[model samples]
Target: MFALYSGSLAEPGDPNPYAGGESLVLPKLWFAGYRRMLRVRIETGPAMQRYRAASRLN
Candidate 1:
């Protein structure tokens, strides 16, 4: 039910397309490693969300 777009660029065809007139180019090999890092951060980020969700449970 959750739709998330992390690596989404301006152009669908190009994975690391230009952004704000600046060229965005990330090595394909590096992407695999980068993706894994981002995945871990995202999954662990829920804890930050939960703490903020409650303003001191009272």
Candidate 2:
């Protein structure tokens, strides 16, 4: 099992509660022979930034 947390702050002065805070839970893979070929990358920085911008527009 894998647990991950990602958060971002829009502004230093402005404290937005809904800025960007997400929790992701990933289950472990029990493959018999595929660990070496499998790869995973988690990059949520850009997505979080976009979300903050959209919120401001609305």
Candidate 3:
């Protein structure tokens, strides 16, 4: 994730290492929310699958 975020995963000699950071810190804040959503999805995925299966049986 860090490599991808830092653009190290891109092809060599890429000009831009990072994007959307002219001066403000808005992108960091947005990334924080995105990480939180991924965490929640991972934590709740099994429970959600179970709920769907049970609902289908009703």
Worst 10 residues of 1 by lDDT: 1-10
Model 3, span 1-28: residue lDDT tens: 5523544233333444334557345445
Instruction: Compare the candidates by TM-score and give the number of the best one.
Output: 3
Cα distance off (Å), candidate 2, residue 23:
27
Given candidate 3, what's the lDDT at residue 36? 59
RMSD of 3: 9.6
Per-residue lDDT, model 2, residue 52, is 78
lDDT of candidate 2 over 2-39, digit per residue (tens): 11111121222333333244522221122211232222
lDDT of 1 at 26: 41
Candidates 2 and 3 compared by TM-score, better number: 3
Each candidate's root-mean-square deviation in Å? 10.9, 16.3, 9.6
The positional error of residue 46 in candidate 2, measured at the CA in angstroms, is 0.2
Residue pairs whose backbone atoms clash in candidate 2: none
The local distance difference test score of each candidate is 0.44, 0.32, 0.54
Question: Of models 2 and 3, which has the larger lDDT?
Answer: 3
